[model samples]
Target: MTGSTGHTDTRKTALVVGASRTLGLALAAEYLRRGWDVIGTVRGSGRTGLHDLAEASGGRLTVESLEMTDPDQISALGDRLARRTLDLLFVNAAITRGDLPIGEVPTDMFTEVMITNALSPMRVVESLRPLVAPAGTIGIMSSDQGSIALNTDGGQDLYRASKSALNQLMRSYAARYADDSRTLLLMDPGWVRTELGGPDAELSVDESIPGVVETIERHQGKPGLHFVDHQGQVVPW
Candidate 1:
């Protein structure tokens, strides 16, 4: 989706901010399936299935190393991708520790969680704003736990806080960049079975991903921070 020509079609370009794992990789594959060009970001230490996916995708996919928390790395990546504009950007890198019940939460753990789960991805989106196509979309992978209106119990203090902060930040970002077709979506992938979502999660990655893809495609023209669930319902802010 190159904005230079003002088109958001199947051949549009996509950038997935974190693709070292199942969800990001699956999203990239889905994009390639739809006949779009995809660039996925993996960490220096992680082993991504990108090579196999790229091979399968023929020539529509590419992978690069990214450290979302580092501003220099973010700038370098933006410079690298400056030539090819992006139609979609997915901020999917996040961390979660199972046990962080209120008073038991440590300071360092809280900081780390905030940095990885919230600040880093926000920075990546901000840095790549210019690359988004005119009628393109940006999605932040948030959670149901992030909804302050629905949270009656607070267990995962760090994770919850970080996501909540992300929600707020993206809401403001959407408003700040309103009046253009560049829409921002704050999506909750629901309880999917991933390394972070754990073994007993409700939805499989396959089930949740299609809904997310459809929602993103449908909402590209709309402007706002929509809290969409895996089933494509609007989650309360």
Candidate 2:
């Protein structure tokens, strides 16, 4: 039977990257509330929202330190977690350049956004893929902005480029791992109120996350890549 939080543990584990606050933290909390063992990462050694969640989890959550931009950190993490199995792995780190257009954005800022939103997540996935059970799911936090097919209006230029690049890169990664059994996902959680999504955003953490977690649970054991929203419907890409 599922717990009050609507998930059955079976001692299943999840590794949530970039889980310091906002949606990432919420994801960790939802999983912990559901009785799943959660390993959540914050970028640095400093205290973060995830630390608070860890303290309250009654030992179901473990907090790990990782700077997603640093490959060395990722490698060390791989060493530490080599023997453990992750039933779900989600990469949720991303940064926005404050509405800067693609051409107007500074080179350094562009680089940071792309690396954080795209390259680093893939690096983490490649390093950690072996640790996921064959039936597990690996998901990356993407946005509807990433959909090339849906970009007719065009805005959030730098942010949009980063996500679109992420979508493309993950597609390449998927092609490379075409025969792999684990389910792969590109998740679009919608425009939610958060530090990143801005206050006027339509959804709340409470509104989007349950369905997000539920969608993930429903996709278990399914293979190939899906770009889906909080409701598990496809997002064009």
Candidate 3:
């Protein structure tokens, strides 16, 4: 039977990337509360929010140390997870430092942002591909800034380019594996009040996640490149 959150009591597995805090933690908690076995990935130890999530999940959750830049670690984790099937895989980790205009942004910083935000998630997906059940889903946390149709003036070049690249990556996955029952989606969580979004953003993480979760539910039967907002509206892609 389904629980209070509409998730079934059946033991499902989910792997959440960048689950140190905020939306990531909230998503993990909601799944655990609904009886899904959750695995959260964080870069380091001593992160308070992750510790709290582990404690709150009551043995239903496991946290793994991950460095997105390191391919070897991702491969090892994939090997470890290969014995079990996964129901959901959420790629949420991304970086945006110094939003200075493109011309002034240091090349190294821009490269790092692309590596973390674009390439890393693809690598994770590749590593974890074997673990996803044929009926499972894979979601990439994407942004509206990535939409070529929506771009007018390109101010935040690095961030915009990175997410746009991610959009392409997700699209490629869908095209190559279209016959596979596993669903692939590029979701825009909207402008949320968080460390990455700042206080002036349009929505809170709490407000965004539930609706995003609902969107995931609604699209459970249909999948491809779904550019959806928190309110379930299709954002331009």
Over the stretch 181-202, how does candidate 3's per-residue lDDT look in tens digits? 7777778899889888889999
lDDT of 1 by residue, 1-237 (tens): 445587745577889888767888888888888888999998895566987797788878988889898999999999998888788988888898766675787778888898998888889989998998877888889999899988897677778889999998887777777776777888888899998888999989999888889988888888766889867799998
Task: For residues 24-96, write the lDDT of model 2, one tens digit per residue.
Answer: 9999999988889999999778999899989988988899999999999999998998867899999999998
TM-score, every prediction: 0.93, 0.94, 0.92
True-structure lDDT of candidate 3: 0.83
TM-score of the candidate numbered 2?
0.94
Give the whole-model CA lDDT for all candidates, comma-separated: 0.85, 0.91, 0.83
Clashes of each: 2, 0, 0
> What's the CA RMSD for each of the models?
2.8, 4.2, 4.1
Off by over 4 Å in 2: 1-9
Candidate 1 runs further than 4 Å off: 1-10
